[model samples]
Target: RVGLVEWEAERHLLMLDIHHIVTDGMSMSIFVEELLRLYNGETLEPLRIQYKEFAAWQQSEPVKERLKRQEAYWLDVLEGELPTLELPTDFVRPAARSFEGDVLPFSIDKQMTDSLQRIADENGATLYMVLLAAYSILLSKYSGQEDFIVGMPVSGRTHADLEPLIGMFVNTLAIRHYPSGEKAFLAYLNEVKETMLGAYDHQDYPFEELVKKLQAPRDQSRNPVFDVMFALETKEDNVQSFGDIKIESYPETHTVSQFDLTLVISLLDEGMNGQFEYATKLFTRNLIDNFAQDLLVIITQICEQPSVLLKDISLNGQSEQEQDVLEAIDIIF
Candidate 1:
């Protein structure tokens, strides 16, 4: 669906709303790129493969065999009892899950960003690995669960042909990690990098298929496998100008949360910015605001001292005694 609202004589708002079933984050960029080319009277080459052809290929025997092998890997990794995160909520969880949510925005300065990148480089890991390691530690501290799963999205455009096509070639990976406080930060990060590499190898397996195969008991109030998700968005300038019309994106007021909590980080030229999109039914705004601040604290501490034990890290600059007092007073948020 597309709409254009005129805000002034020379200004307008263009809204392009597409369902997630047909397009993803990567596809949106492709769509906008082609849209601009056509708007500027530039011709685009015909797609090598249409969406239907790609769907058909997925159902082919060879793809089926490949998925079977990948399924074995997922099952082995997620074998035995699954851990459910028990994060303390501000309100009682609803009988049914709610999509109502809000975003808490935050940013990391270029200095810290560069430091993080250095750590990633020293450890032979990507920035995503470094951030994910820090995020896992925060979740462990909050939920008091050393082992749990966090959903990560993978761009499932494995083949070059699929890249130019605007379709839903995105897959969710249930990445489980055990963040032990006793372990050194660098050691844990390397472990996370290894686990992520393995998950990426089997990322082609559909998440829906994994859920069906796992046959876990359904919970109406939460998502299966993982309650929280994390994603790092690589920067892309999708639409620049439509023949000097000065095209740009317009922000929307309505927000939705597909999970209990989702942390999205975007790598920009200036630095790294992030937002925590969380379900309002399960968290207060103040609580999530503190989460954003505390996350930055965790990242700063770990980046400065990679050898620091995870347990030594502090949130919101609170000592253990102070944290306990706040918990006792029931005013931590």
Candidate 2:
């Protein structure tokens, strides 16, 4: 049994326990919702198929054909390009072996969230586009490269049958960003929206197939394509109670990826919470914290003043420190 207990100064301690098989981030959310609904006397129909069945069906021919198209598209897009983001390392980036990283989070107020949403709506774009634009600008500043790549997670559950079942139906797709001065923020966001839509239209392709088709070099030193991943999860109130046995769903341990960094944003009561996970061996905690804050500041500033140029977003006096770290890394590498 896996259990967690916490002590509070003002309130009594809370304890939680669950079987490993039934507990996961996604399952926890669903379980809490169902528990509440059941308590309210809401009867739900039985599920048509179990998760295992869905997994088996996912390996069928139609899915394979769709994946092939996705592989072809990615190969065409990434043909001969190397990673645009340059790391200050002399040693090659490691591959095959999985690495772990930690997360640093920054919070935004309700006003900021509302403002960003409004801007996105006004431009007929998505919140994802606004966030992606900010990320692109951040990458440009850090790497000193106007062209960079970010890997985004796509929900591969396109058909109705796959939605109810839980499995690893997630695919990573690379988005190439090129900041052209000729394009306005709104125009650039529109392009991103279109690209993402196209990606979704053909997301059934297996990522492994895409890698093979690209003939991506097998390097023990780095990831095949992109290192940074961005994900945004929509939030909901998830609380459960059975008489005196109350259980509140709160994130305990966050899973770290084998990439250099992963940026995740989830909605909170007041605003959005930004989380940044970085490889500890490659970066210091302070660096990760600063990077998160910088991205937040850039996004907030852009939302407040849409006319600002990409180059105008400053690190708020943190640039010197970042440069120092980069230089030290260069020397060590």
Candidate 3:
């Protein structure tokens, strides 16, 4: 999926599509680092272990007990008939799901970013925790269910041995939160904080093993367990030069994803950027646009009144016609 957009035959946008199968988020950084080192003709030490060796060792007998405890924890946390959110879609959903999608890019102004950070600092939590709690609130508004699950990607590089290896060391963990209608948004952050800590502690459980341990009912039209995802992309301070031609980061052109909807918060030098990637077969651009705007509004609302109950928060107002369409599918917002 590589292409070139000609601009008067002087400049062009070079696009390259690297599938997640070949690598993941963290691997891309390592790939560029090694590529630069090789391009500079630097003498490097011999490799000690390859990705295949790491994979084989992961399934060895030494970590079975540790993995078993994680398996039990995940099984207990994710036990229930996972609710499939009835999101508003423009087109009819096909029996089989496709990866067709687009990314809606937005930015958080400096003021908003600063306010969010203040909220995080006051609550003794990271911005990621604040963002996840805000997203959970938005999801609860969209889907009328009080309890739901969201899947978040975790960097599964637990040991230093796998840091330099360009491989699939990323894993997805299901974070289930039961939003109490009476609790304040700040109180809810504590719940998200706890969930994040527990998930990281048990991250040694292989995702494939977790899937096998709890064989949930299969749904070809949607992904297993959870369909929504939230991730924060932190800026990496890597400057590599290949002779005189130094490599610079470019805006992402690939937007398609396997999930129903994914919200990626990119922390940039100027401000924070938000990208909403949703399945075109199951969601429309307008619907995703409303969601993106509503999420920002929710963040503002929470920052203003951290003590407000989760149920009392007001989402951005949508048109009556849009409201009707969403309600037709049981969506509240």
Candidate number achieving the greatest TM-score relative to the actual structure: 1
The lDDT of model 3 is 0.81
For 106-169, candidate 2 gives per-residue lDDT tens digits of: 8878888888888889988778888888787777667777667788887666677656654566
- Candidate 1 lDDT, 37-145, residue by residue in tens: 8888999998899999999999999999999999999999998878888887999999999999989889998899999999999989999999999999889888878
Error of 2 at 261 (Å): 0.9
Candidate 2: residue 274 lDDT (0-100): 82
Question: Each candidate's lDDT (Cα)?
Answer: 0.89, 0.71, 0.81
Error (Å) of candidate 2 at residue 74 is 2.0
Query: Could you estimate the TM-score for every candidate?
Result: 0.93, 0.78, 0.86
Error of 1 at 61 (Å): 1.1
In candidate 2, stretches whose alpha carbon ends up further than 4 angstroms from where it belongs are 1-28, 31-44, 87-98, 242-244, 250-257, 317-333
lDDT of 3 by residue, 165-227 (tens): 878888888888777667888889988999889999998787777777778887778787788
Q: Which window of 10 residues has the lowest lDDT sum in candidate 2?
A: 88-97
The clash count for each model shown is 0, 5, 0
Name model 1 segments beyond 4 Å from true: 7-10, 237-239, 318-333
Residue pair clashes in candidate 2:
67-205, 93-221, 93-222, 94-221, 95-220
